[model samples]
Target chain A: MIYQTVIGLEVHLQLSTKTKAFCGCIIDFGRAPNTCVCPICLGFPGTLPVYNKEALNSAIKVALAFNCQIQEHTKFDRKNYFYPDLPKNYQISQYDLPLSRNGYLYIYRDNKPKRIGITRIHLEEDAGKLIHEDGQSLVDFNRAGIPLIEIVSEPDLFSPQEAFDYLTNLKSIIEYLDVSDCDMEKGSLRCDANISLRKAGSLELGVKTELKNMNSFKGVKDALSFEVGRQAELLDRGGDMVQETRLWDAEKGVTVSMRTKEGAKDYRYFPDPDLTRFHINQDMIERLRLKLPELPQEKLQRFMKEYSLSEYDAKILVSSKEDARFSEECIRIYPGKDKKLMVNWLIGPLLSEANSRKVKISELNITNDELISLIGFVERGEISGLSAKGVLSQMIDSGKSARELIIESNLLQVSDTEELSKIIESVILENTKSVDDFRSGKTNALMFLVGQVMKKSSGKANPKIVGQLLSRRLTDA
Target chain B: MAIDNETIRHVAHLARIDLQAKELERLHVQLHEILGFIDKISNLNIEDVLPASHILPISNVLREDIPHTSLTPERALENAPSKKGNFFSVPKIIE
Candidate 1:
């Protein structure tokens, strides 16, 4: 009895506007509790609510990027609920009509794009934070009234890894838009999944459970995997499915039922009286669409075609907007060089350095000009690839360019054919046994002789010339 | 379209308002009268008309994206029922 897994995600992204959604209060993530609040955000009497135009603009940019159709008339609604974190009894959100809908984000699977349907993207106000310590809970109102957009996806994902891929692509698109930071650790982006399991090839769907509180993208994948297995086992054992919301206990690594349908909250939604409707115009959408940057997928295809980069290298370079821009900058700065070399250094050594330092590649102290100059040294045969790595490490640490670092450290590669030949002759004479082995057709002995030449030259001699001169000297002998 | 006693009690419970039995009975009648008055509009054939959420003719009421000075922690927490330091304290939530 094989089963199929169906998944959909509702992601909440906090827009990085300077002010709160409906008020003029400052929006800061880690500020002191209750500090970033004003009368309007605090839900005080006589404080009329006004929408933030910047938030609406960011939402439109994201919606357009996801290929959603912006509704001509969108309005805010009040979702009534009782929670300690919500300063107001109701959260101003969208109901019946959202800002945008029917968008699709294409994720690459098996080198082809798979379009995932976006149900809607709506604007809402975030609740405050609740910190429970000892016996009581304390609420921080700083996050309250922050503008958030709920992106609901249709049940198009068939596997947990597909969901992970969808989220990665989605995050990349959002980062490219520059609307939100989308940092999961700081709670700027959060995801919850609705997953159900059905018999393989069956048209009917199983009763699904809504999974909440998955902290990371990997957590989402793992939680959905566990839920699929659990539901499949339950059906195999002839157990009835229960419609409920489950919490992902990350520590226990299991889905625990948070609430059943009996206690389920019915958020009685109604049009919020304080805020008016937003009539999106064609002029505004066209202006933003013109301003939209080249997306990751488009950039990826262009990188492969224009730069002649391998699909693997192009994909890695375009994974982050910063890295993609950095690669382009390097290519632009150092024209007439092998783009493959730049791609290799960026994907290999530069990326590893950034990873070790726990910073973004663009945030590395070295500039693109510095990196291109470093590659230029290698291109001109002034430094070996090995020596260039040493120079790059120092450059990252001390903010120095490649040329300065090479001079200061005297890492210039010794490519002089005369000097290398003299060292190679001495090595052939000193290692007569290896010379005898090379003459006896033990071809690997030539490498040992070349290693001796490099060691005698203090690793400054170019290995390529060293190998060539050593082979020439041995055969001549 | 008419309101019933059971429905009134359920709505009251959902709203977290505890109602006495006599109060529920009285409100049930009053709620039905209000519904009965409003139900007259249902008889009109207004299928082509759009449902209006707001009566105002204006739309797109929005403000600029700028931050003004926020209230101090003291002022923000001033009206809370209970406050501890800079936070609003509440009963421990188990779930």
Candidate 2:
């Protein structure tokens, strides 16, 4: 059956704050079990939670970066659930009055920007970790009460690929905001997806399943893809799907039914009476807005316009904040009218060098002066392109100037006409048979003589100059 | 507003209050009477008033995001009925 997939993702981003959301417990990961716990986070009776100012600021920064409309008035709610991980049995989260709403994130579709609606972003406290053992489960409260902003997206994604793109772009922007590290392996960024498959062109929506346990963005995409296939197969066999919560078994590469999804009524959400509402003022929003860095989209658009880079090239260059800065720094120092040369090296040899080193391009030890001088050698025909490549590797490795590497490696191209004339004279004397072959209409013999000059110079001789000089000397004499 | 017996049972279950049958019957009558008395406040004319989350006009009660020392694991787990090493042990929950 031809079906259209609808997906909405919920990302829980842990703010890189020093302390917990409602307490001053240090929020360090990989610590001793329950070492970071306190009365406020452990839910001791009569304990009151004080909101973290930095957490609120980080949450607002994320909302502003995504262009979400900040709520004038926002309050926390008690989301009641029966889970051992939740020490309080009720998670303090935002319900009706979230931090912000009605934002959108841009995902690339068919080489054009597609705006995926961001339903809302709310601030909440994370639950604890549960590790199961024989006949018992142990709970660690260290992770509890960490400030987490839940970014919920509208069901604008139509395919698994779009969902992947949405997450990738979302993570990029969040990193640029410097709110969270967006590290999935550290459990700093977690994702849950709700997907439904409806008959193609159907207006009415199909029953959706909420998928969880996706530790990485790729895990979410793969789970969604597998779910789509599972649902489509079931529907084709005339079987209906029930709305449920499923867990992604990344090892098995399949999503298994965990439990029935609870309704909003089961949660019984209510405004948290302990923490009072805060009026998010225009002054605060404007302040955070000023602090927002030039986001991925803004940087990409500017790169295309100012640097004359294609969208593909601009997107690649601006994907990482550091790489974009490195490219821009190189271009700014480049002594040329058209910066395409700088862009080419950035997206070409430099990128390959970075890839081979298993690091970002900016992470390479490439200074602007050295790199520009390296490229300048190739442009002025002073060094052969091959020699420049060798010099570039040395420059990146040694952190030395291009001139230093060139001189140290003896890679300076023999481009001087007078100097090359002497080599050509030697090549003509040594390879007289090839010279005779060339003058007698053996056109290929000219290349043989050029190779002799290159060999005599130990590969420092520029092929273009040697070719030109050898052919000119042979034909003119 | 008339409160139903089922709702009373649901609320008791949600609150984890395991009440006896006689206690449930008696409380159902008392709770309805209480709700009926409180529902009279709805008749007051307050159409011009804005909804308030808190009554004391208090807001923005917060603290700086500075890490402060808290109870050690030994102190934090002092009251736990069951402890496995430093963590609180409970019945194994697979899900």
Candidate 3:
């Protein structure tokens, strides 16, 4: 029997505000243990916590970008728990009424737009870090009270691939909004998944399990894939799933049950007395809406229509904000409107160069002017496209201009008729067999003669011009 | 729903507090009375009244985005029950 999988994600994105959510401590990562702490974040007595306006504004910007409905009146609540990392023994979070709700994130699957409903986007403070040493644990409160936005998506994703696509799309929008870096490695953006399996076309949902410890998008997809198979096998054996929280042991590649059904905790949530309700007005929402940049979807559509590119090419260009910016900048400076060429370079060679260098495409040292100039050399017949690739490698290494590299390395294409004729004469004199074969009605021999000429010219001769001159000379001979 | 002994025990466990059987019995009774008062409010016929998250009419209580000097390591760890080289030491958690 076939089964269908359902997946939902909750991503916690640390806002890039200058200071902590409540206190005025500067937000710095990888600081010396807990030196950024203050009385307010340390949860000392007689210290009243105040909300940060920048955090709220950032949260509203993200909510509007996702098309969420902002709640006019929302308040913070205390999520009570007993963790060594939490000095206050409770987290300041939104329980019943969150800041926003009822939104959607659109992801393209199989060339069609799929909408995944966003349940809510709530603001909360981050917890501290716990480092375990030999026989003891260290608590660092520097990260405590940092502003975080929890984006919860509805259970609309039906496959692990769709879930991955949804996450990629979500991260793209977050990056474009300039709210957070969304770096998974630095722990700025973290994700947890809820997945279950049921019979195809079943009305009621199946027993779901919460998965944790997935650090990257690939890890999330792999964990979901593993869970889907596990649940399907249990159902085949006439067994049922138990409700619990499972930890994704990424190294071992399996989900281990961290707690069983009885492990569910009653948070006993109540309104935080310290923070007052937030009354979001229509004017505030409109102002934030205007601040929302052209998100990934809008930019993707515009790139396709304006550049006259295929959806596949446009999607690749707009997937990352940096790549999209590079493409647009190169096009703006290029003398000709060859968007396809720019798309090919940005998505093809430039991406490969970045990967080989183990850096982001935006971190590539080649400037837009250098790239445009390199492409211009090819368009102007100064260098063959093949020769330009060599020049590009040197340009990337030395951070020199394309023209500088071409002239320094003598990589100019041999398009001059008088100069190329000498190289062609020598190639014909040596390759007598191929010349005879070409006269005997073998067209493939003519290409061999052209290759010989290019080799003699040290690959500087333009192959197109070489082919034309070789055909004429062979016919005359 | 009425507050029960099982709920009280679970809540105490979540709060990380150890409670005796006699104490649990006393707390269950006290919670029932408190919840009873709250239940009475729930039974009132105020359908048109907007649910208020806070009693005060104040909203948008916020602070500006500015950085201030933080406490030094000495004062930051002053009240810690256990300390080791500028960090608060706690019992080792395996997970």
Best by lDDT: 2
In the range A44-155, model 3's lDDT, one tens digit per residue, is 8889899999999999999999989999888999998778888788899999899999999888867888899999999999999999999899999999999999999999
Note each model's CA RMSD in angstroms: 1.9, 3.0, 2.3
Tens-place lDDT per residue, model 2, B24-84, is 8999899999999999879888899998777778998889988889888999999899999
Ranking by TM-score: 1, 3, 2
Q: Candidate 1: lDDT of A227? A: 97
Worst 10 residues of 3 chain A by lDDT: A259-268
The CAPRI quality class of candidate 3 comes to medium
True contacts kept of 3: 0.90
TM-score of chain B of each: 0.87, 0.87, 0.90
DockQ of 3: 0.79
Candidate ordering by DockQ (highest first): 1, 2, 3
lDDT (Cα atoms) of all candidates against the true structure: 0.90, 0.91, 0.89
- For model 1, how does the per-residue alpha-carbon lDDT over A228-290 read when each residue is reduced to its tens digit? 999999999999999889999999999999864486677899998888988999999999899
| Residues A162-263 of candidate 2: C-alpha lDDT, one tens digit per residue | 999999999999988888989887899999999999999998789999999998888988999999999999999999799888999999999999865454
Candidate 1 off by > 4 Å: A260-264, A416-422, B44-49
Per-model TM values vs. the true structure: 0.96, 0.90, 0.95
Total clashing residue pairs per candidate?
0, 0, 0
At residue A368, give the lDDT of candidate 2: 72
Provide the DockQ value for model 1.
Answer: 0.84
List the DockQ of the predictions in order. Answer: 0.84, 0.81, 0.79
